[model samples]
Target: MNLLWLAVMILALSIGIFLFSLRWIRRWIREDIQRRQAASGKLNAIFEWAERGRQDSLRGLVLPGADLRGADLGPGQEGEPGADLSYSNLRGANLRSVNLRNTNLEGTNLEKANLRGANLKGANLRNANLKRADLTSANLRDADLRGADLKGADLWLTSYNSGTRWPDGFKPPMEAIRMEEE
Candidate 1:
């Protein structure tokens, strides 16, 4: 009778431990799934119009702190294939390593956007509002910034060349470094 009692107690403890571990594992798995789903939803929303070759206007759009690395908004203009994101609101968005090459962003509101390490080569940003935007280490070679409102923008260690056109009479910030190669 004593031996049987000891065996039952040990089995109960083992079962309890197993059950606790299973619950912990399930909780973590659920959290991970939720995170992935949210990220996927944001990515899909940004790329849906671009992939479908739709030239829809993304004006006044709001998407802050979103991970938009290597994304292409579209090639600007009606004749070409791509979406027009003029006057869109992308404050505080994470645009690291994004591809805005040749895309038109005229009059777009990009205040406080994190454009670190972004690729904005040849992008048409005429009259765009880039106030206080963090553009550290970004590639701005050949980008057109005529009439762009770049007040208080951070351009430290950015890569730009002679082809990068600035707004009329807008002196570049002293921290903005020019690229050696044209």
Candidate 2:
């Protein structure tokens, strides 16, 4: 009789542990799914905003901390490809830690914009007005800056790899060069 009682208690404990573990696993899975869904929703919103900005020239548009990785912002012209963000005004906008890899920003007016810690790898900034913009610690690796005016822009600790393209006769700050060395 005592043996039978001991076996029942052991079985109950095992079942209880199994149930607890199952609940915990399910909860973790649900949370992961929720997080992915939220990320997707945020990405969709950013895409919509970019599209709207393209149509309206992004005048006075503000999209701080947007994750636009692999997004196309070139012109939608017939037979021409790329996400078009040309002729847009983004003055004083906060874009801290945002990802704008491979984005097209030709002729965009970004005067006084705050792009601190942003990733602009491989972006095209030909003729873009970036006067007084804050690019502290931003990554501009392989970015094309032909004709882009960056006068008075804060490039402290900014990263620029060897593949980075600059305007004619343009010189990068010492701090940016140091970051590349590190």
- What's the TM-score of every candidate structure? 0.65, 0.57
Tens-digit lDDT track of model 1 for 130-168: 999989988888888999888989999888889999999
Clashing pairs in 1: none
Highest-scoring model, lDDT: 1
Model 2: pairs clashing at backbone N, Cα or C within 3 Å: 72-83, 73-83, 73-84, 74-82, 74-83, 74-84, 75-84
**Could you tell me the TM-score of candidate 1?**
0.65
Off by over 4 Å in 2: 1-83, 178-182
RMSD of each: 7.7, 12.1
For candidate 2, which ten residues in a row score worst on lDDT?
Answer: 56-65
Encode model 2's per-residue lDDT on 35-120: one tens digit a residue: 66765685575578666654533332333233443454444443333444556555665667766666677777778887887777
TM-score of candidate 2 on Cα atoms, chains taken together: 0.57
